[model samples]
Target: MQHRFEDKIIDTVIYTALLVLSLVSLYPFWNALVISLNSGADTSLGGVTVWPRAFTLDNYQVVLSDPRFFRALFMTVLRTVCGTAASIFFTALLAYGLSRKGTMGRKYYMLAAIFTMYFQGGLIPTYLWLRELGLFNNFWVLFVPWIISVWNMIVFRTFFQGLPEGLEESAKIDGCSFRIVLPLSGPVIATLSLFQAVLFWNEWFASGIYINDESLLPVQNYLMNMINSNSAQEMISQLSGVSGGVGDMVTRTITPKSLQMTALMVVSFPIMLVYPFVQKFFVKGVMVGSLKE
Candidate 1:
């Protein structure tokens, strides 16, 4: 009875500790969300916590009403979709070719690819190269520079190697080419696609250098410039870029912090949604190649 009491106490203590840690980790996001959902003016007045003091959609209305915001959102979607698709397609194709042990000059091909991971022309040289290629200030500039991801290739290679050796033999005996065989690597492909999608979605630094067109800006870039502008009026102007319909409601209910938090939530919301859908594959991939094996 003494030992039973001691174990129960220990378990309770451990669970309590974990719960506190979880709350500590989550509180900032909770606070931000509360502030976002609350009346912006009330949020600025302070003391907002886990729940909104006064619930309103004016902050989101300000966000959704902007034409520029929609354009940036569209471009962000394009970058995530197109970049993720192209990266996986090309990286997997190259990885498939390299994974075949029977291929000629495979070592040289792998060496060439690996070399790129460690070395690149410095920023000036890259900028000059883009200029020469006439890619600067263009929407295609976003797509051109992200054609392949070396790290993802290495991961794909590792995952491909971990696939059953007998599967290769079976495919060979069945006389199936890459078209048939590659589709069977769904687990790793889905995992890699998720990885590259997040990368493309979060990427904005490339735009800071290569792109100047307002029309071509992705959400990250647009949000970043507004955040860094460090002026409340400038940020408000961004809110206005969305829609004039929300102008009166936003002016009455919104504040700068509310808009900023909303932008962050907007940036994060899509990826958060995407992860849950692919989470099973993500966990399975990690268990198979990345973490355990």
Candidate 2:
């Protein structure tokens, strides 16, 4: 009876600790949501806390109405789709080739991949190379530079290596080629493909560095310019007509904390929606692929 009571106490403590940690991790997202929904007046007055003190959808309405917002969102979606597809196709092909133990010149390919991970021609040289290739200011610039990630390739290769040798041998006896073997490697492919999708979706640095044209801006770059541009402040002042001060004007224009939170929510919503569906495959991939046989 005493031992049973002690075990119950331990379980209770563990559950309570986990509950606390979950709440702590989730607090910021909850706070951001609350702030985004609160009225600008209430937000400026610091009325929002854990819950919104005054409800308003005006912030989202304003953000969505802006043409730049839609343009950036569209470009980001395009980049994510194209980049992820290209990454999965090339990474799968390379990884499968590398998984074969005695494939000729495999060492050189492996060395080339590893060398890329450790060192690169710095940004300027890469930019100059891109310029020389005439890929500058092109939409292909987003997908081409990141067709394969070395780390992703390694992960995929290890996963391929871990597949049962019997499967390949059976396929070979049936006169099946490497192409046939590839279609059969679906789970690992899905896992790597999802990883590539997440990387492409979250990326902003490439867009920021390579894309200067307003039409080419990804969501991150668009949001960055919105946050930095002086004209944004003037527009905010005209809309709200709240002459709180220059400090207030700057706050309203450059980084309306509420609007920034809304932008973050917008940018992250698609990924968050996607992650739940792919999460099981992601975990499975990492667990099965992490260990080398």
The lDDT leader among the candidates is 1
Candidate 2, position 246, lDDT: 38
Per-model tally of clashing residue pairs: 6, 0
lDDT of 2 by residue, 1-293 (tens): 99999999999999999999999999999989988788656677765779888776666766776778898889888988898888888987888899899789998999999999999999999888888888767788877888988888887788778778888787788887565667766666767777777777777777777777889878877667666765355546555655555345334433366677777778878877877777767666667677765
lDDT (0 to 1) per candidate: 0.80, 0.77
Cα deviation in Å at residue 152, candidate 2?
1.2
- List model 1 lDDT by residue over 1-293, tens digit each: 99999999999999999999999999998887888789988887878887999999778776776677889989989988988888888988787778778889989988988898899888899899999999988878887687788877777777677667787777778887565657767777888888888888999999878888889989998788767776445656655555666656666777888888887777778888998888878767655566425
**Each model's Cα RMSD:** 3.4, 4.4
The lDDT, on a scale of 0 to 1, for candidate 2 is 0.77
